[model samples]
Target: MEEESGLSDVLPRDLASLFSDTYTEESHYQFCGQQLRITQLYGARLGVAAPVWDAALNLCSFFEEQKLNFKGKKIIELGAGTGIVGILLSLLGGDVTLTDLPHTLPQIEKNVSANILAGCPPNVCALSWGFDQVNFPQDYDFVIGADIVYLKETYDLLLCTLQHLCGPSTTMFLSSKMRAEHGTVDFFQHVLPKHFNVDLQWRNVEDNINIYKVTQFQN
Candidate 1:
């Protein structure tokens, strides 16, 4: 995707549309203790018309702490809504693949390009996810998603997607406000241990979020 030309192209207007009323271009959120560029795009209008909420950004503090040399390692991000997290990984040097349902691909592409306004880096495009086949790189080093679990029916497909990408060395990181919804904790408990070694790092009840590290192998 091409880098979007202007800052006006990426800014958000409404508070409710942004998931949290607090994040703005001037907001300083310290994650992992680094002052990093962060964008919150949930419900931020994107696309040919307006954007939909299917993804969000990575806290660069936490992201920078992650030692992924994107130089050649294969990385695939599931449910990449705004595509921020995946793009950041790509920017850091990974051979990145961004995947989301077909409906969200366009905005994902748009934001990918928009974020690259600072610079256009090369990376793979969007793909529709499937459970039956592990179609991309078989030896994936990392797989990640943010705020993806909120439904029961999607549990089967989400697990299928994660399993297809895991190969004994893959690491998975999922972040979420873990907002009140159907089957929230059940989804985490059922799928977390079965697919990857789960680590509950921290929880910010005030922010309604949690941090987890699920890896393919203990390091």
Candidate 2:
């Protein structure tokens, strides 16, 4: 299927066919020469419909291009709303931990189990931004997140969590849609830079999402 600039621009007929009353859909995709399946739970009040967000799509493609070696590496995705990013990494040989709110774990687990082999399937755990401290092995080589910066209230907590998860060698890949609301970029402008060495990696104009590759700066 050809990529559309954004979901808002879905054609009338296409829109009807794209959605389901069941609020769940199976998406088939190929990444790095491997066939993968993603089961997405949509229309949930608790942010389950994030799989279609442009940021997610952009990050998926961005990783395919970069093809950073994930084999035998420890990777974790914060706010793994649909578990797509981590699932992809796991498919590429990374030991992945997909973390999200408790309510969202089932969907993440389903996607992971369906795609990853049984023995070493990606770990699906509950992680509340700024609230829960999960006891997973630390020093994650890569921390990934998408569209996780929507709320200003969670900015400090998110940063603190990232600081805890990221060591000097760890790299964080974040994709956020730029909101038109005033001060939407305030986190990027004021908070993120104060903590990490941030670099803009990619921007998808259709969805207005900016992808940043960041690493923690030593104090």
Best by lDDT: 2
Clashing pairs in 2: none
Candidate 2 least-lDDT 10 residues: 1-10
The collision pairs in model 1 are 4-113, 45-51, 46-51, 54-81, 55-81, 70-93, 70-94, 71-93
Assess candidate 1 and give its lDDT. Answer: 0.56
lDDT of 2 by residue, 1-219 (tens): 111123333324545445434467788887677677888776423333335566777888898888778999899898887788888888888989888877778888888888877558888887776667546555889999887776555667788788788888898999888773524477776678988898889988877889999997777
| CA lDDT of every candidate | 0.56, 0.74
When superposed on Cα atoms, how far off is each prediction in RMSD? 7.8, 5.5
lDDT by residue for model 1 over 1-219, one digit each (tens)? 111222133334443344333332312233333232434333323221122222233333356656535567677777666566676666666677777655556656765665555544435455544543356666878777776665555667677767677778777777754644456576676656876788866565665666677777555
Tell me how many clashing residue pairs each candidate has. 8, 0
Candidate 1 is scored at a TM of 0.67
Candidate 2 stretches greater than 4 Å from native? 1-22, 48-50, 180-184
Residue-level lDDT for 29 in candidate 2: 80
The ten-residue window of minimal lDDT in model 1 covers 1-10
